[model samples]
Target: MAGGRKPCRAVTARLRRSVNRRPGTASPCPWPCTFYSVVAGHLDGGEEVKAAAIRDAREGAGITIAPENMRVVGVMHRRAGDERIDFFLVAERWTGGIVNAEPHKCDDLSWFDLDRLPENVIPYVRRAIESFHRGVWFDSFGWEE
Candidate 1:
């Protein structure tokens, strides 16, 4: 791991924005991807899982979220090349707008429709998103059966 830590756990937020198209509209619809990484950070000592999710969202994406508004949508256990447990959370309600608080870590941040994800998305990430859409609760990757 980049940081000196073991048994690492990370959090990612899935923020969805709905686009409604009215009748007789000729404009191209800009339905951005609903799955976006709001924030991610290592789980600190004695920190509750939900607390970490809220903290990461604020620190990484500059968005304030409440514990009540966030829900655990899915989880991925990845060990292809690295070992990690990823927590995927879906936030329906949040306060404040989203901004790339850590520009140095991330160069670009934008919403992408689930159907039209970028080609650069990691295989596990794409799998997780698909699992999310299909309402799958748990998944494991890079592990021999």
Candidate 2:
């Protein structure tokens, strides 16, 4: 949470597998940064958390994830020029092929092994993935002590 009364809320969809046997995660390119980042977007007015994750997955990744197959892995209160709460949810299953639903916004969409993620993932995204693997639930980023 931020200093404001209502901080913006966002959702990041982390896929456990994208129609592959290997355990992996997929994301879009973080434009201008050359780093990979998961499917994420701001929540709509009065949208539920998991519902937003499902919606973002479809809108950003061209996949449909059932609410029952998605689970909250982590939550981050981040401050990067703005304060926002990010929900990181992992989906064990999804239907349809994975594609870059927003080519204009993303250069490419690809999957990486969970144990061998690329070195150039977005900082907080990488942190969230690591935290998910480590079973940590809550984190704060971009805020100085």
Top candidate by TM-score: 2
Error of 2 at 116 (Å): 0.9
Model 2, stretches more than 4 Å misplaced? 1-5, 15-31
Residues 80-120 of candidate 2: C-alpha lDDT, one tens digit per residue: 76677888888888899888776666666777787788777
Q: Name model 1 segments beyond 4 Å from true.
A: 1-38, 80-82
Per-residue accuracy of model 1 over 1-145 as CA lDDT, tens digit each: 4577666455454435311111112322222333233345667768877788788778767888888998888888878455788887777888988776656555556676777776655556678778888889899877866
Worst 10 contiguous positions by lDDT, candidate 1? 18-27
TM-scores of the models, in the order given: 0.73, 0.81
- Relative to the unseen true structure, what is the C-alpha lDDT of residue 90 in candidate 2, on a scale of 0 to 100? 83
Report the number of the highest-lDDT candidate.
2
What's the lDDT for candidate 2?
Answer: 0.72
Each prediction's whole-model lDDT (CA): 0.64, 0.72
